[model samples]
Target: MTDAEQQYESSKPLFEKSYPSNGAAEPAGESEPQAADTQQPQFQTDEAFASAQLTLRALVSSKEAGVIIGKQGKNVADLREATGVKAGVSKPVPGVHDRVLSVTGTLEGVAKAYSMAAQTLIDSPPPSASSLSSGTTSIRLLISHNQMGTIIGRQGLKIKSIQDECSVRMVASKEMLPNSTERIVEVQGAAESIRLAVWEIGKCLVEDWQRATGTILYNPQPKEFGSSSSGGGGGGGGYSGPRVRTGNPADFDSPDGADQTQNIAIPADMVGCIIGRGGAKIQEIRRVSGARISIAKQPHDESGERMFTIRGTADENERALFMLYEQLEHEKVRRQMEDQEQDE
Candidate 1:
């Protein structure tokens, strides 16, 4: 194992330690604490409450994301206005049909925004979802895979209780997001039930955040090039497995300075997504980041990995690389889903 992996293993137990309860009620006469059942889980200390902030991230399909963003970002603006929270959608990653919707604020604002987003989705599902049963919608939130056990509780009691109380169906995906330690927990039901469930789930996350986010998950080894024939033959639809090195977004981002160039090995199959339809995606990346990027015409040696070259100032390169990383991640997830569907 690499140094990082070893360190992660050594520190693994820290995240496994029990956390404080989810705002259990204090003595009745001592003080009337905030309604933890109806609102966010209460922080133990007033100081903690004054300084606390939470950010919730959820995965939405392309169409659903469009609705959340609305035309010219009016929908997101409306959400921010309504919930008194900072609401935003991630930029479209190439070849990735799913986008992340991020809401930041106090726990109360997040819950409100989460509900508003859910309600909006229920009222305005994509046309493709019209065939589904009416009055039901699904929202997928990104939860740390390591914390799944906490959410599940011992013998599955916690999740069961949440489902029973909120009248929602919750399923946490066994598969983590590509190159990351987070997975999707899909909650499906009516808007109100979903809203309640979201609040409960958010509480679980808040309680576990200290240990969960600090826990490091080792990156799974990438498969050898051409190992999967699904999207082989240079079609760029093949699954090359996860080659992303770092999951941290801040790694590439640096203050502008000397010009630099870097080469990343791209699986032969993923080049199509990076390039987009008729090169529009790549061009967009260049336009936005002011970085010059070039793709190798042939595989790097016998590994079948194409050399993706980027050149620019530090900031520009970082920006371009960041976009590429996001694109690759989303594409990986999409392809995995496709393969799973095909297998089924």
Candidate 2:
């Protein structure tokens, strides 16, 4: 871990003041050493862990996305310039209503960015805003399945405690993201309440990641999509997979004959990015997901959306869908940035 990360680990108290203590009552005089997983990782001091380099992700509705992105992406650009954090919103994925927003930087920077984003959400009008009159908004965080149990606690007590303490309502989705080991957790309330809820949730994520990976920083998977290089720019690393086969989706059906199929409607304009140059992107998706994918040569209807079909086991289909969604979102962010630059 970098020095900043080390400092952030040490300074956890600042951001995680409300995290519940893990003090269990042991049998008197029979204090045998406990397993690391059973214990909560403790931090030394305050302020610095808030400086550790980390990334926090959330799923937001497209309307809320526009508010955070602002006209010509000015709001997001301003967010980065003012807070020293990297903020990115994935491009709109066909069939998916929510876009993934990533904020990467010191703990303090990420918190500030979220606070500003939350305020923006509150100030907006109906439908997009959760409740303007009540000064309330909601943020849906994309959390991995494994870490979720920690946040939910045994029989939902943990999640309830967090909501009661922060004065926010929190819920974890029952449905998982396609090809993903993650699900969304929605927290709603006033901006400050949301901040505290997020802080508590973020603390749990960091601790769980540390226990599993032995590191202070948490790097979520599928965090990179549609970049020129698969894994560059602190994206963790590169991707290497089996040779890709590209052709009719029918050619890759299951040998066991247990095949399930699903179709997604993709906007005509966004299909090219998912297919990538020379079909490299689609091939990669096929290889990684082991799903048979084919896009209609023509638009499905007057709506001008193409029918993208996937054939595989239930697992493969979901994975393929998730990967495809990330590709579109990545492309969307890229185009938005480009447009912003052109206006400048």
Candidate 3:
């Protein structure tokens, strides 16, 4: 046998010793292996020889994780007992807001556990929205990175207000889009509740924009006067109005310098979403952000993901990156819904 094959054969007993047997029978005249059998190895019996273990991973917002785990992990513990699976949820990834759920067990156990978890997500009723007559539904909102603070409000007051007023379960992801600064906000509840929440969110965005632009009427400012001044004779002395700021606005671009470039990797299939219909989306992003963006012809990662290089001032590059990620997130949700529909 080849060296690799021989090595694998040599490790077979060790592998069997590490894991529990699949309800296998003990050899005749041999006592069942003790739970603390440090050297004894067990093998699958003929009845369950085909049994195999598998792991499934899923992403869920931290808020949803709380529901899945229930009070003091009761929910997850119950699910494990009912489905004969080992389930665990990891803390949110370093930069992402979503936690990772892992279900490991026999194929059937994994499927059962996953289905149960998914149903739990779908069936969990929103707080105080039971009075709404509309059917339940779920939707995801893509919030711009810069606007997230406004939506969340100081000390989470705004989000709390939306939840209490609209009666929908809202979860904002901790992780930004794969390579972008935007995050996903998931809302679930009766259709009417969702609509109200969305409307409220839109209002918040508008208010933030107005505040940023100093367009809100609450903050009045004196209008700038032309060359003709009330003080007469071009002396223009008594003009106490706000000075007319000239030149370009502050470049808030990258701190690494305007010439600094960034490269991001995106899955091959998602490239089309970022490109949009006939490259329209990519072109729009470039125009709006003043960033030169290009995609590589070859796959840049082992996962068959492609590389995109963005060149511009820090701000421009960030804008382009956000736009691309926003589009990608939309595409991801669309595809997931489609798959779920197909399965149904």
Candidate 4:
């Protein structure tokens, strides 16, 4: 046998043994059924094992963690129910602003849950300015390796055009994402500029997909694209297509009725960042915003993250959200700088 084939054969047993399985038990008060006359003979082998358990970890920013949890914890609940996996977010590591999301279950369950969580993190929008701030806004987009070339184009022409037209700085990561077949594209500029750059990059990706598959991936209807009659359908009656919804809609408006409640998921490790050294920061926010904030007990199924419920008027809830987001953004920047330093 060739060296590569022999090597693979030698390691086969080791690989199989590494995944220890749960022992099987015979049915109670039951005897083994006898084989039929035409039944094929069964062979005894070590492959006879029960289901194997697996665990995986994913790193996410506090903002992304909130997206994974969803409104009223619906997203995570659905994930568990659909995949039969137990998933939890870890409190922020003592010094890091990022949280570790943990998924554990049978092999199949873990794989499904991990894929769902990874996609959610990849698709989640980066943190944005809650108030009017002239400071540059930085956003990260995860793009698959195959699509990266489309965005970059020959000699980086496409990306250069985007930067020149949108007035935004764009950088693609040199390395592939950890345990993923994607890379990170970082865009920095004013909110509007960033949006323009994203749109252009998306257009490139769509064109590439169409050419490769000979199928139009994004075919907007006449009403959706816009009608010349209504001044290019600039939010006029000419465009009557469905709106593409993004982010948690519940976050946009306050709860109906007198009492308004907003639920926010804070990474366990960074909970301290929000609470401050001695609850000073949280107390200050409550006093100034008049929002009653309380941390809810971690759900049995959720780990590595804590939930906070803020109760008050619409204004108060908005104020609390602003403060929380601002603090998380600061932490994110600090951690990012530290990582860069370590890399250097």
- Please name the candidate that would achieve the greatest lDDT relative to the true structure: 1
lDDT for each residue of candidate 3 in 1-344, tens digit (9 for 90 to 100): 43322211111111111222232221211121112213222323522311445433445666767777777777788888997876766433334445545555665565456556545655774353224234554455555545566665544455656666666666665545532344566665654455456555654544443222211001011233233221211111121111121123343343656455677666566677778899898999899878898888998546566778877876677567656654654444345333322332
The list of candidate 2 runs beyond 4 A from truth reads 1-42, 126-133, 210-344
TM-score of 4: 0.29
Per-model tally of clashing residue pairs: 0, 4, 6, 8
Instruction: Look at candidate 1 and tell me the lDDT of residue 331.
Output: 60
* Residue 153 lDDT, candidate 2, scale 0-100: 66
* CA lDDT of each prediction against the hidden true structure: 0.62, 0.61, 0.51, 0.49
- Per-residue lDDT of 1-344 in model 4, one digit per residue for the tens? 43322211111111121222332211211121121334332322212111344333345566766777776667777778988876654333333345545555654565456445544544554474222234454455555455666666544555556666666666665555432344556665655465456555554543343222211111112322423211112211122221122134564564443457666656565677779988998898788778899875663134445667788777776566656654653444344334422332
Q: Per-residue lDDT of 1-344 in model 2, one digit per residue for the tens?
A: 43322211111122343645443211211221122455746544446456666667888878888898888888888888878987877556445566668887777678678878888887763274543336877788877665666776654556666766677766566556644456677776777777777766766666566422211111233433323222221121222111122234664464554677777766666778779899999999899878999888997677566778888876676578767765754554455445434443
Root-mean-square deviation (CA) per prediction: 15.0, 12.3, 26.6, 26.6
Candidate 1, residues 149-259: lDDT per residue as tens digits?
666664455665666667776766655665556777777777777767777777776766643532222122233332432223232234433343332345466456756
Ranked by lDDT from best down, the candidates are 1, 2, 3, 4
Q: What is the Cα-based lDDT of residue 8 in candidate 4?
A: 13
Measured against the true structure, the TM-scores of the candidates, in listed sequence, are 0.51, 0.54, 0.39, 0.29
Q: Candidate 3: global Cα-lDDT?
A: 0.51
